[model samples]
Target chain A: MAERVVEARHLSKVYQMGDVEVHALRGLSLDINRGEAMAIMGPSGSGKSTLMNILGCLDRPSAGSYHLDGESVANLDDDQLADIRNRKVGFVFQTFNLLRRTSALENVELPLRYAGVGAGRRQRAIAALEAVGLGERLDHRPNELSGGQQQRVAIARALVNEPAIIMADEPTGNLDSKAGADIMKLLLKLNRQDGKTLIIVTHDSDVAEQTDRIVLIRDGQVEADRKLGRSKKIASKGK
Target chain B: MDFIASLQAAIESITANKLRSALTVLGIVIGVGAVIAMLAIGRGAQDSIAGSIEGIGTNLLFVMRGDSQNQVRNPQPLTMDDAAALSDVFQAPSVINVAPLLQGSATVSARGESTTTTLNGITSEHEAVRGWSVSEGEFINSSHLLGRSAVVLLGTAVADDLFGRHDGLVGETVRINGQPFRVIGILAERGTGGFSNENDTVMVPLTTAQARLLQRSTPRSVDVILVQAVDADAVPQASEQVANILRTRHRTALGADDFTIINQQDFLDTAASITGVLTIFLGGIAAISLLVGGIGIMNIMLVSVIERTREIGLRKALGARKRDILFQFLAESSLLSLIGGILGITLGWLISVGVGAIAAAANADIVPKIGIDSVLLATLFSMAVGLFFGLYPANQAANLQPVEALRYE
Candidate 1:
């Protein structure tokens, strides 16, 4: 029922190596609605990662029409793409690509720095870290923290800028089962309570079952789109 | 990031690689130190020469008879009457004092000890012209001339050689050219004057030497006519007047002139110009070492860029601008050279002080004067070397693409 936040038409990504041309994404079109928690499920080489990159504005589609919040991203330059990534989209990686030598607070403050936020905006960063249950570990660096804490710091960094959408690539792939479940719970809480659009790419069936809807991607095309009945149980527990 | 942060990062990185940084900086240190030390020694030598020339008095002039060709052909000496005629006839306000010198070499014996020395016949005013002072007893004066006393003033070297640790040679008789002459004074040591030893000569009144020692008619044949100008500012005028008067007395026109007037001021100026040129030549050669040091910096920076490729890529991925990366490397290189320059300056100063001490111990007239300009120049040159050599690698780092850099392992 919510308005569509992302619209893609005839999107294709190609790579050229020597004389060989490989198409990573093939003529894909999709729409992502606002306030929706969706999981894009696919096996290896299914082009899910490519789709996620294109959606996050990290890489451009070779030939396609991508409208992110009603703005065409297909014709944008690298800087413009980076600007869109900085201003609109937030990314969380499976490995938690946080700066190794810097503290958690500084990691969350990175996007704010790109946004030209002054030092006075530190309170916003503290709030974001506290939102991810990482307020107590703000001064700890990535190497000093546990796996779950590091992922929480990454999530805090992703949500610090209050972006339009959070695109995660196997956000819990590197964590243990318990940590993975905890991260899933946090993602679900962010989706339902904060009303943020969340698109996660994962191969785990249990993780996919937690989202509001699941879109099965096979060979760079959507195979099935289903809304979950289990969301009702999670929604009851959210209150 | 802010400048302070960037500088702090650069310093931290440099400090982390302590041995590598120290070795790199050592090249610059030696280069700068050599440049400073060489220039200081050269400058000190120049100053010493100029100081010695000044001690001899710039207002003095020497008039010698005949040109080089005639001196080779006839070896005819000048007459004392010629000196008097010029002194009386010139009548210029710039003319202050004139003395004629007749020099000859002979063996002088005293108390069974003998030394070969140069004997010089001169007037009382010769002391003023030659800037000589008596170390002990009286100099030959009007009384000695009026009495035609056979008296001589022994130079320090002559007295030391002939007397052999004896004190107060005054009133003692020393035989000059086989004739006895009482020692009236001992002249202070005047050091060497390039061509010969100045302290090996003995002085006596011209009339007394001619009458008693030389046994020659006219008794006026002289080697040089010494003249002192009334003031330093009047030397040029006095020199020209003496030349003109001598030429008139000799009845010679320009180009056919028989006498040569040597101006001490002109000689000092010429010596200064020559030493300046020598200093630049030596300094230029020494600057080559600095250039080599700069090349060493370039070599090291290139290697550093290659070694830190991953770090550069990571920083670029973190949103560092091209200028940021460039400034980081440039700052590192500059710090290397700056530290080296400081150490080099200190080393050069210590070396100069050590050299000065050695010279002082040996009682040599050489004094090394280290200048402030050399230190400042070395510092600036080292910085310039850093900037110049660091440019290529910095450019390579700055131009790296963020995507390619992030993908770099």
Candidate 2:
């Protein structure tokens, strides 16, 4: 009975490389409801990243109908897609992707800046950083932060806009086991406490086990979809 | 993103690499500085030349023998009669006064010293016509002209050269080419203004020069005539009126007048045009350096675009539009060039002042003139160069696809 956050039907993508036609995606349909913490598992070249990119509004599906929050995203221009990305979705990357030489506070405030939210930007940015237990590291640049701290800052930036969906691509890939566990726990806390719709693409089975649903991707199509029981505290700190 | 935020990011990026930014701005600085200095020097030269020309007296015209197509040998030169006719206000209404002159070099001896000096034959009104003043004694009066007196006025230079210690030159005898002539006056020293040296000549009456000094078969032929207008604004009208009178009197048709009239203002205009051309030429050369500087900006901006590929990708992924990236880079480039322009203007002003000081020390006539207009123009031009040259790189940054750029590692 929950409102569907993403309604994608029959998406296909073909990339031409000189004389060879490379079919990265066949036809794939997907639907994710509100407050669903989903994990997409795939091997390399399986077109999992491509679907993630499309759903995040970073790219348009080659042949498909995509409705994000009931708005048709297939025909939207770049600016409109950017607006959707800014206001409706947030992204976290394995690399943390924070602007170098910029403070953590500024990094967290970037979305608000793009949304034209000027007043109280500093206070809100501080509060967001504080929410992520990074209050003292607001002035620290990305290079100065630890791997876990950097990922925490990225998560703080993602949560700043209160986006309808949080999309992360290998969010813990660059971290060690312990830092990866911390990041996964933080993501779980966002899903539980903030009620965010979390969608993450990862190859780690242990990381996948913590999600409420697991969607397996192969050859640009969804191979299997399964609903998991409640989180079994896959991240040790979450227990 | 908002403009202020983008600008802040740009400023931070620029400040992060101080040496690179400074090196990048050097081209714009030198380009703009060279332009300012060239303009200042050009304007300064023009003003000084005009100042010296105006020193020769305003609204004054010189009528000299040009070419005579009808007469081949010793074509009738401007005579004292012609000067007298022009002096008649009824005949040439714009012509205020005229002085007929005859000049020749002669050995002037006083006491035991002798020096070769220019001998000018002029009447008393020559003082008023030439804006000259006497320092010691009276100038050549009407009586001296009528009596054909054997007397001379010693210019300060020739007077000093011949009679260094001798005083009372007013009544002293100074021989002109072995002919004894009484020294009547010593002219004031008015440093070289190119209307001949004011303090380096000897003057006698026009009648006496024809009678005893430069004796010729012709009775009243003078070498040149100096005509003064009533006022500054009346000069062009006065020149035309004088030309008309001379044309009618000589029976020469239009464009066939045997005499050439040169107003002081003509010298001013000619000098101005020469300096103006020089300014443009120098500014153009400097602008080439500016052009090169703009290219330098483009080159570095392209490099920056390449280096920030990942940053561009991340911003796009984080919801930055293409125009946002374009505006950010463009704003950074413009800020770079504008800062360079400000520094360059300051440096150019300093260079001009320093050069002016050196010129003053060396006794040069002109001082470098830096105008506010040049500064404002330089600033605007630098920013325009920044914007113009920055377009390609900014476009390159904006056109990157987020997926491709993110994979640029």
Candidate 3:
């Protein structure tokens, strides 16, 4: 009954290392509805990162049927996938990926620039930075900001596009626990208040405990799919 | 992304490593500057030489008394009779004027000042043949020759030396080798050009100089004859005709003549080939530097791609297509070359102007000029080098995978 934001019937990815064929993913199929906060957890070499890359449209599966918002994406060309990624999905990497020496406002406006959204772009960027509590650091470069502030700016960049879903791969991996907790809280609040679909890929159980659903991957297949009832009720409406 | 924004990003990156970018473009600057300065010098030298040749008289041809290799004094040298024969209307229509010259050096004095200078005894027709015009008074005429008048014309430098800028210079009497001669005319002050200075000699009538100044007998012989052709294109024909007449007059077989001829067109052709070869030599050396500059650009661009791999990854993640990355690096490298080109042109212009100033101060004829061609060449060369050298590195950057680039440490 819910609107499906991500639907993967069968997914596989193979990497060639010299003469060896390494199967990073094998027949992995998963789905996430709109406005849901979920975590994909796996150990190293379990293909969770590959799955996240495939879901984010940054990498295509070797064999799969992927339907994102009812559009067949598995057979799309590179440029077509790039267009889809530009307009539909936002990615948050573990390193924050803020451009060095670039102002926080400019970094946030980068996606909008690629999307050809002009006229009042700076104002929108400013508004997004303000939403992330980075209004005072608009002019500051990445080196000028603290780890927490940088991650906040990265979040503003991802949210600026208002994509169908946000994919975060170990977003808090490089932060101190305090900064990590703050980032997790921000992600949780975005899901609850703004009704945004959030997918966080990680190896930490404690971090995964904050989400509403958990899909554990092992050897590139779904090992467990569990639903959680947290202290705050999960929001079901899309903003 | 829009073009302006891409350029802005490129500029930001270039400014981020200002020292490296400057060092990278130094080769281009030097190369372009060398090209422009060399072209100016070559162009200036050719122009100066051409001007002097024209000043010597484009339609003039010379008939020396002897061959080019030897200056022999024959029992029968070329006389006014030969000049008359060459100027006869039926014999050669292209011959405009023929002037016979008998040259000698003597100590000339007026009042207390004296200077040793060459004196030329020539006919009034010398004015038309040699392209020398009097600025004051009148040149020696036929009456001066028939009467053997004790009158002379002072060259510009000669007048300044003997009269010391004195007024009434035309009326002043200058004694030459002990005989006082009245100054009837003063030659104009033409600069020392590619040819000899025309303003540094004194002139007298041919018959008077032969009879009185040098005291020679009748049927006197002259040293050289000046013949003016009707036009530039007729110089070869006029020269051949004069040679043929001289051979006949001397009663010699062909190629065994007593006199030799030098035409203005032959001198011009020799001068042009010399300057042309020199220009290509200098330009070829400068173009080598440009090739070196192109290689330098390629080397720096490769290093830039490696240094900014993470940044490339970041842009790709930020939704930049392959073209976006390609354009960014290409624009950055080309901006480097464009800036270098502008700087080089400015430096070249300054050096050329400095050369001209030095030449002028040294009383030299060379005046270097920077024209539009060198400007256009420098600009186009730099841009072409930038684009051509920027190709491989930009492609390398653009072809980088977003995931691998993001993963690059």
Candidate 4:
């Protein structure tokens, strides 16, 4: 009886590349619950990236309905979708896409700037950075920080908006094994202690095994949904 | 985002690429500079022409006997009697004074120095009517005219040529047509006027010149009559009155009068119109460069939009609306023109000063006029150019799809 944070009935996306039609997604259906740490895995051309894009509100499905945090958003306009992305879905790209030559704190404050949060933005951004163990690196630019530290700053940016879900696309794809493990631990902690819903898109099984659930996408549809070790909240409720 | 924030962001981006920003605004700077300098020079030329005309005399009429346009064959000469008739206040109410000039070129010599110069036969009233004054000694008087004395007032140029000095020439004797005449005064230098050089002539009593200097066709005949009006506003009335009296005296019908009354205002109006055309022509040419500068802005903005495609995408991904993107680009371009405009003003002023300096070095009496109106116009026009040229690139940036732009390499 857990509350669902994401509910996708069916989705399809077709992209026209010149004269040919390319089907990136078709009949995709998936659900993720609140406070869940889930990983979506698929091979190349399996449409996992397309699903992530749809779920993050960066793109709309050509045919299908999607509900993120109980709001039907598949039919929303680009501006409305942008608002949804700003308010409900935070994104962490694989490239650590922090703005060049910008201080870490300013990069984190960007979403709040767009959200039109005026006076308290600085304080909130600082708190988010401090939560990610980057309080001392507030003024350090992305180039000045280590790979692990850069990813932590990205996490802080994602967390600053307090979105319903943080979508991290291959969060550790560009990080070393040690930095990757640290980021994985941090993301898991946010889900476990702070009850934040987390959806990570990665092909690494080792990374998938750490999540509470793994949904494998094949040819734009969910091919498998598997639950691994017991989640802390469920175990605590059982006790 | 708010305007201030967008402006701040635009400034940040512009400053980040300082070299490109500077180069982009250089076109605008040159354009505005050209506009300001051209306008200043044009206005200066107009002012100098008007100044030279006014420098001669205002509210005065030059009356000559022949109507040159009519090609009058054997035209009757203007006479001293006609001058007396026009001087009668009952006949010409606007007339203030009348002076007759009987001039002839002669060989004048002083202390073994001789220069061929014009001898002007003028009564004492001629000084006030011509606005000419003596720097050292007195002008001809009634006694000099009645006595027909052999005394003369030296013009500055004549004095300088004959005596190597303009002042202290009084009591020195000079010869007109080989007849010795005492120098009574030195007339102050009057620079060249619209028609001729007033500084290169010698003045003598009318009776003396009529009796001693040259052979005349008639005893009462004069070369030209100078008429003065009460004020500048009385010129038209004074002119009509003088014409009527002359026509009646000459026994000629309307339009067949053998005389021309040249109003000083006519010369002023003609110069004003000519210089007006010159100012507009110069300004129009400069405005073309400004238009080119606007195109340069547009060209650079388009390049910037292409170069910063990913940045635009990133801003959009962060929840920037279309208007926000549009305004950001527009702000950057406008800021460029604003900076260029200020710098261009300084450059333009320097150019005008340089031009004035060159003119002064060449002994030309021209001063470049830089008015606040032109500066304001250049500033506002440059800014408008920036905004106008910025529209297309800004629109292009705003319409960029986030997904496509983010993917742009």
Candidate 5:
């Protein structure tokens, strides 16, 4: 049995929208093991966002238990959740959320700064940027870079802390076809070479085909969990 | 996040919006500058007043007729005899010198230039007791007072009024109330001191004035008796001694004496209290502007927090804790004020120096005083305003939900 990095069972979330109860999630259960690249896909209102938020530690489940990397985090307070997010879950957003007017090197070092990693921050951030093929663009601000380069910087920021899982939400949504392909290639490289578990939320089937498995959600429940390749180790080695 | 990172981030944010940051800092700059300049002017006025008070001879006592407005019996006027008694070493040992003055306003003409000015009948002892020295020729001598000769010493203003100059007036003749008196000396300028213009008086021999210019009902009644104590420490003793001698000489009871004693220190205390109040008043008005500046900071901070909502969401998603966001905003606001405070101090110092320059150009005796205490107070107070006013907006930023913030346009 491969070591499970994420184990969530029967999760549910209800939002109070001004005296109306809106159910965002309902009895959702999923599991992701170490070093696996998985894509979560659903329609706009199918509760995929809520699941991503819960699994990414940006939010807690209103009901049910969740354990990430063997720690029960379903009932963690806000600060404790923040710590878990810092140490375990790295995020890459659709908009390439590199801080404006900041150098790529500094943007990549941001996570290390928040994690209180002192003295060796520059070395680690430089290594991460180099891993994304942006070592020479370290001094360039976000606006000075191409859309693909900006996303690379975002990926570097995500990788600097070596989080257990990199959660990418439409990471290539705003890029051109060429840039999107390049970004996908870089993300897969990181997953395969470093054995980093990757979870992507995307609506593009082509992007989903690149992952080892795909989980489809509907009406706040997992509708299908499909495997497109062999087991985790074989898939990573084959890629 | 650590303090250094927060500070760096704050600097980056402020520099990104240069115009807005400068405008925000302008409010604080004006507030602190106004506060410092007002305090400096107030202190300068206080210092000039103190300087004039000290310029008057120290340890001096003024003996005047008591207040008789509410009294039934009229108070006896001070006389030359009382002055003579106070000068007696055995009777009042603390009394160093006593100079009797009999003064009245008169019209004096010299070289067809006439002006109505104060005429004083003063003995030779008046020079030492009043701290006025002759700038040209000689002062009133004992022989001149004894023989009751018509000799006069011209105060600078009177000399300038009569002859268009202060010096070279020796042996000149000036008429007082239709009587001619020779100008033997010109008195040096003494500026204004303690309710009277010292340079606006003309002096003549006491005997000459008594016999020729003005006469009283009593043989030797005088208007004021000026007594000098040995030193500052001897003023109270000298006052008590002079009061006792006058009570005995006039045969009046204690607490019902016919004379009043005024000391130089009384003027100092009164002037100090008045200027102290003026300083606080000026500073209080300036503090209102400082409060307004603080509100300006709060307003700008609130706007900044709203504008950076998406950035805050991104930070939180990237694993920034609540305090990290809180500290970033707080650091930005206080850094605004801190920079403003430093620049404001420079602005304030420049204003004080400018005021001093203007005063000097106007020939006024004021020098703006900028003390270190005021500088320190303005710096600390402005920073506190920034921090205090920054709390609400920073809290709003820290308490934002990442999902909603990320969704915000």
Candidate 6:
């Protein structure tokens, strides 16, 4: 009964390279409600990454409409998109795109700086790092940390702004099985405990299974949507 | 970002690329140094020349027989009669003194030592007209002229050359052009004058020099007439009045006037104008080097933009405005030039002081001075060069598309 935080209707994205035309998205339609954890899975070249890009506001769909939090996202300009990305959405990348020479605390403070939050940036950044269990590693740079630790710092950076939704693209694509499971647990905790809308795109069946709902995609179309378990809360409460 | 943070970042970035930044600043340093040094040297030379000329007396005028522009036209020379006529006819309140000169050069021998020396014959007024004095004995007087004595005044150099460390050769006799003449006085040292040594000269009474030394028939034609104005301010009027009297005496028309009258103040003005031109020329050449330095800054800045493309992308991704990028780059380039400019000015001032010290030690007339205005100008010029050359690369960085920039390897 929660309000839909993301709405898409007949969205399509096409790319032109020289004389060739490519379709990245084909008339995609979906809705993601608040406080829900959703996973998008597909084979290679299945337009799932493109859909994630559009959903994260990193790219725009070429056709049809997208409404994020009841606002038409399809018509938003680059600045407005950045505003939305800064205030409403946080992105976690699989590559752990933390600045190489900067410390973990500074990396987490990057979003706050963009948001023009001047005072107590260090304190807020430390809180975010502690939220990801990285309080002791706040001063370590990405090169000084392990792959899992770096991903944790990146996630901390994404979460520091307290956005409405967290969109992660293959959040555990580069990690081993154990580290990947640890990252998935953290994302699930953020969703269930914080009541944040979580949307993840991945190829791993284990990662897809941990989400509340799995939306299977193929050839740029949604093939199926299925609920998993009792949706975390119901199971935890023994309902 | 705030200006202070941006400036700090710029400083850090420049420090990271130490070699490139140093080389870029080196260009500006050399340019500003050259400009300051050249102007200092040129000004020193001009001041030395003007000082020496002014030392000869500013209230004096030289009336020569031929015009400078029409050297081919031969004219009759001024004689003793003409000199006397001017002394009588143009006896204005502004005219202080008049001395007619008959000049010739000869080899003089004393004590078996022989040296070539200039010989000048004049009356007692000559000493006042040229602002010269005697170091030993007395200058030609009315009594020396009336007696028509075969007496002469030896210049310091001439006396040193012919008499060799002798003290006061006033009573001694030296042979001038195979004729014996008594050395009545010794003239003080007056330093070099253009191409000749002003001190290596002899002075004699006009009547004695014309009648006895050369034995000319028609009262030996005077080569130059020296005139002294009563006051420095009266020099112009005195020169004009003397020119009129000379033209009437010589019976010459406007363009055909035989004598050339040069006022000392007018000579100084001309010298100053020439010095002005030389200063500009030197400054212009130095400015070219500064321009080259500016281009060097631009070239290095462009390379820096290429090297830091990924940094630009990262900053833009973190919400840096285009103006922030522009200002950061500008601050870096400006800091480079400003440092160079400061060093260059210091180097130039040190050079001037060193040269001045050397000149003073050697008792030379050169006086090199570095002006405060030049330092200020050089600083301003360096900043301008920084801003101008830093623009292209700053614009290039500011205009980078964040998406494409992030993808830059």
Which parts of model 5 have CA positions greater than 4 angstroms off?
Answer: A230-233, A236-239, B68-73, B191-197, B214-219
**Model 6: native contacts recovered, as a fraction:** 0.08
What are the TM-scores, per candidate, against the unseen true structure? 0.79, 0.90, 0.88, 0.91, 0.95, 0.82
Locate the minimum summed-lDDT window of 10 residues in model 2 chain B.
B67-76
lDDT of each: 0.79, 0.87, 0.86, 0.88, 0.89, 0.82
TM-score of chain A, predicted model 4, versus the true chain A, to 2 decimals: 0.96
* DockQ, cand. 2: 0.72
Clashing pairs in 3: none
Lowest-sum lDDT 10-residue window in model 3 chain B: B67-76
Candidate 4 achieves a global lDDT of: 0.88
Best by lDDT: 5
- True-structure lDDT of candidate 3: 0.86
Error of 5 at B394 (Å): 1.6
Q: Least lDDT summed over 10 consecutive residues: which range in candidate 5 chain A? A: A229-238
Cα lDDT for residue A105, candidate 4: 92
lDDT of 4 by residue, B220-265 (tens): 6888898999998999999999999998888786557799888878
Q: Is the docking of candidate 2 incorrect, acceptable, medium or high quality?
A: medium
Q: Where's the lowest-lDDT run of ten residues in candidate 1 chain B?
A: B68-77
Summarize candidate 4's per-residue lDDT along A11-84 as a digit string, tens digits. 99999999999898988888888989999999989998889888988788999999999999999887787788
Model 5 scores a TM of 0.95
Cα lDDT tens digits, model 2, A43-100, are 9999998899889988888898999988899878888888898888988999999998
lDDT of 5 by residue, B234-345 (tens): 9999999998898888888555877778888888899999999999999999889988988999999999999999999888887788899999999999999988888888
Stretches of candidate 2 exceeding 4 Å from the true structure: A231-239, B68-74, B104-119, B146-184, B191-204, B207-219, B233-237, B240-255
Question: How would you class the docking of model 6?
Answer: acceptable
Q: What fraction of the genuine interface contacts, i.e. the true contacts, does candidate 4 reproduce?
A: 0.36
Interface root-mean-square deviation, each candidate: 3.9, 0.9, 1.2, 1.4, 0.9, 3.1
lDDT for each residue of candidate 5 in A43-141, tens digit (9 for 90 to 100): 999999999999999888899999999999999877788788888988989999889978999999998988999999999999999999999999999
What's model 1's lDDT at A192? 89
True contacts kept of each: 0.00, 0.74, 0.49, 0.36, 0.64, 0.08
